[model samples]
Target: MARRPLVVIGSGLAGLTCAWASDPQGCILLTAGVLTDGAASMWAQGGIAAALSPDDSTALHAEDTWRAGAFAGDRAVIDRITGVAPEVVRLLVELEVPFDRAPDGSIDLALEGGHSRSRVAHAGDHSGAAVTTAMARAVRAAPHVEVREHHTVTRLLADASGAVCGVEVRRRDGSLEVIETDRVVLATGGMGGLWAHTTNPTTALGQGVALAARVGARTDDLHLVQFHPTALDVAADPMPLLTEALRGAGAKLVSDGARFVDELQPRDVVAAAVWEQLTEGRTVRLDARGINRVATRFPAVAELTAASGLDLTRDLLPVRPALHYSMGGVTVDDTGRSSVPGLWAVGEVSRTGLHGANRLASNSLLEAVVTGRAAAADAITWTGVWRGSVRPADPATVRTRTCTAAPAASRPLPLAQVRETLDSACGVLRDGPTLQAAVDCLEPHVGDDAAYVAWLIARSALAHPLSVGAHRRTDNVLPEGVSA
Candidate 1:
């Protein structure tokens, strides 16, 4: 019998956690970049959502999650996740993650937008980075896990029976290799990087979504994309995120010294308010000056602001909405089983109905941990039944076809064009005319990597006629029949 490999793709929290939980004696973890380099998890500052507060209950957390999801969430999935959240937090603590603590030695919690209680566990403002680094360290020390860098998965290969058998990946040197495996897991993050202005890393190009869609996976809710309201509008092109924890700590969203909107509103409300202000010729700013005394409470935000040449005592940071999270992807069950056999998805890449139309504050990290572990357990059970019959596919030898002449290198899309089109047509406002115009303007570059992402975004945006959660349309208002 041949040795079977369990291949896990993407190196973010979801992928790493799955690898750790699978405990596959010799599983291989493949990633396109540094484990922490391109993941949105490292950029998360608000912390993980869990019912760790004595005053809070899982029912309350579930209620808030369902509300933020615009009532489209699956109650069963929500209950399961909320019920298991405390254990997930415990697992992170056991992994040696340095969570912030109170003077009395209790775990400190913070509040963020769309939450009724202070139940978020954080490490100041660097919660995601701390958790990711801790997990990466543990994975590295584990003798059974193998981490492969600079490998990008191009396509998922299926056997004659239409089950996923392995993956075809492009190496750093542009060579392709097929890794035959009995099980494959996709932990690729969201599609925020597809937009011109996003807080996500450049590597988040919807490769996983595209690959799964191409392979006939049932994807849902692709129209819903969450926009974070406070991406610092500085010299940075993609913009840096100012965590929602600042608002939860009493920072105000003001324009010209007047409070323009409720600071504690859900992300979509805040983002739309800012967009309205921008359209009205008023510059939107997040007022953190009043919270300067509490600056020591959030070391990460304070340090980052200082490094960016802004003084919390005097400066009102300019901000704008940027692509933050995706509430859509390949559909999956509570156990992370995809529509296809021998394949699973977890984290941001999988639409497990936990987030519904929009994700609640700080819930992404929790979802990743819970579903990641479940996927691994499912894989273990699956291997028990299928391992005996699985065989590695033989490498096919074929001659490479060479072109007679070299074609000219195509010029990259102009930055100005990319930004203008998205801002005008696909920003906070949308209509039949604008979406059609956007599709026309971006159609020529559809085959381009960035253009494909833009295309998928627009298509998804156009598919749904009603505006829900993070998605808003000037022509369409919230439906009266739908209950929140």
Candidate 2:
């Protein structure tokens, strides 16, 4: 019998990198939407982080990463990921992804919050879209790689011994089918979409978390979700993000038209500071008046602001803390292997211990490519023996659900009730009682992917007693009632 193809579940940079690195002839790429549009990667505004400047080094980058994650991340993993960051940038350049360049032809780096050096390489403000478009072009030309769009993987398939075999997919026509495969790489995006106010696509409901957990894969740090402090406070669902690059360009955060928190502090600190102001009913906004050629430097942001009846050059854009990134996920090793056998995770889906609590501004894109390559290299050679279990499960799938299905809704749970529950219980400030209450309220809806992930996040928050990084708890007060 012929060997089954390696299945990759996502279209983000991580998934694309895995497909390009793997044996293309045996690689199958699946996307819940169009190849380039669905991923949160394309929504990324700040660029990839790298220590490529003359005055910088990997050690400094690693130091910044460890500090931003609140010292809880694995130091070794930070060193490994930061060490390879420069090379990742070079690879992207070679692939014709145009990074912004200085006058002397050096990679122009932007200094975002929590970084000691200007090491983020970007192409304008649409860094994610530009990079993803270039990678998608390359993948489209690769004849051996099969790209399937609009096919949502509802569940992961595993044998009785806990070795993964395939996935249950929801097709475009509203029918479900199963694809049999031995290797599965989940590059699914973060759980930001579960929150009422987030920057991620609505479909990014942590399907990867639910799918993996149902099969007994271990997850961690689900509570360590980073809330970006400057999402444009409009009436839109999934609020538009104000790029950290603005702060790097000298924008300031102001309340009552007066500056308050330092705009370039670590994300958790800045977010909490902003949340304090918001709770006090003060208006927080990103003041971008000082940036020269603001529209030219950040055209995408200019467009977004223009649509909202404002100008990045002249307006004090109202802002608030909103769910931006998840720092914890299905726990994985250096090679993106989850505890479960024959299954791997990369990108935001896998907790590689690189981002222990709060992620540095641009480290996510770097980790995506680095870990994606690792999982692909390992998956290419694995012989389907997971953790010493030699059970030879056939690559045949069995469908367990009825063919009919309801059209997927944008919000997973009761939109109004769950939003209030998550924002109040798992928002910037959290406590034991509220976390437990949020879990209890959402427990009945755990069958829904969004609600299940929200429940997982709340449960994780309740389990960790101390206020560390993004997982802040009001009740876990220290000597000064602040983090050390």
Candidate 1, residue 392: how far the Cα is off, in Å: 27
Candidate 1 residues 39-124, lDDT tens each? 88888898999888889999999999999888888899999998888888899999988999989897898989889999899998
Model 1: residues with Cα > 4 Å off, grouped in runs: 24-26, 383-423, 440-449, 477-484
lDDT of 2: 0.85
What TM-score, to 2 decimals, does candidate 1 have?
0.89
Worst 10 residues of 1 by lDDT: 397-406
The 0-to-1 C-alpha lDDT of every candidate, in the order given, reads 0.78, 0.85
lDDT for each residue of candidate 2 in 277-360, tens digit (9 for 90 to 100): 989999898988899998999999889888899989888999999999988888888888887798899998888899878999
With a 3 Å backbone cut-off (N, CA, C), the pairs that clash in candidate 2 are none
| Model 2: worst 10 consecutive residues (lDDT sum) | 395-404
**Any residue pairs clashing in model 1, and if so which?**
none
